[model samples]
Target: MSKQKRNTHSPELKAKVALEAVRGLKTANEIAQEFGVHPVQVGQWKKALLADSASLFDKKRGPKPKPEYQSDEKLYGEIGRLKMELDWLKKKSGINLP
Candidate 1:
């Protein structure tokens, strides 16, 4: 028995077909035939594009906000290391910092 692999279209091709459908320049059946896909597939892609089109403009146009990933324990460890180095330098110089 021979197994047949399913056809997977690239994102670019799907976008092209969906855009054509949205433009009303071609019917779903015509777009599907031209794109070598099923009519149902063309309709699905068009619906998905239309549904998600609003999100394209909904995003803010600026640099993304960075996440605060620093932990309190990590910060405390850095402070402790700096304090130890300062104390060592003071002892070596024979200078008291009270």
Candidate 2:
């Protein structure tokens, strides 16, 4: 027996199905049958949409906060230290560099 390839649905189609599920106008089985997807998938999408909807309005307007651990001075110092170690190793190994 040959294995059947799984079908991939587009984001738009998923949104439509989820929206329909949220509206409660039709049952999950009906929505799944109409959209050619499993009822579980429809329920999952609806749950995800509802969960993320709050974050849509919670976003703050302005530049995002910078991370605490990142600094240009620290990065440059690390690079210089690495270069010195590499040079020391090369000289000790008698590897000539032009």
Candidate 3:
């Protein structure tokens, strides 16, 4: 048996087929045949388009908000403390670290 090469459809093509499916003017099988894809794919695209349509309008038009966490100064202080403790331990053990 030989495996057939998979077809990669562009986002524009997917949107077109999905829009056709959403119009109810043509069946999934017809849309698939016209677009050279499986009927299942057309159905899936249509479903995703319908489901995500609301998100297009719901999105805010600006940069994303920053996360709330400990400031960089606090983190740097902790790192310095750890380094000092490591240096003290190395000195007591006679372990020279370059």
Candidate 4:
């Protein structure tokens, strides 16, 4: 028999329950039974909370923001490398421009 998945809670409610489960006020099994959800889901929430707690200590809170990459130095390095390649190509192809 195929099992049906039922998402009975909203995102806000899920987060609330997960946070409550992570807080250890009640066991995951208890929360799962109360919420009519699987214990595995509550366990997953607890695991996620514990794994991510260290990053939450900063001034920023909530979900961690995606890191901003591509520094100016990397851009400059790429430009220089491309310029060198262009110069080499021009010399090899004997291309003269106005």
Q: TM-score, each model?
A: 0.62, 0.66, 0.66, 0.48
Cα lDDT tens digits, model 1, 12-94, are 99999999999998888899999899999999999999999999998998887765565667788899999999999999999
Q: What is candidate 4's lDDT per residue for 26-48, written digit by digit as tens? A: 98888988888898988877687
Candidate 1 Cα errors over 4 Å, as ranges: 65-98
Runs of candidate 2 with Cα error greater than 4 angstroms are 72-98
Error of 2 at 86 (Å): 18
Score residue 89 of candidate 4 by CA lDDT.
90
**Cα RMSD (Å) between model 1 and the true structure?**
4.5
Candidate 2 TM-score to native? 0.66
User: Evaluated with lDDT, which candidate comes out highest?
Assistant: 2
Runs in model 3 with CA error above 4 Å? Answer: 70-98
Tens digits of per-residue lDDT for model 3 on 35-58? 899999999999999999999899
Judged by whole-model lDDT over C-alpha atoms, candidate 1 comes out at 0.92
Residue 51 of model 1: what lDDT? 98
lDDT of each: 0.92, 0.93, 0.92, 0.80
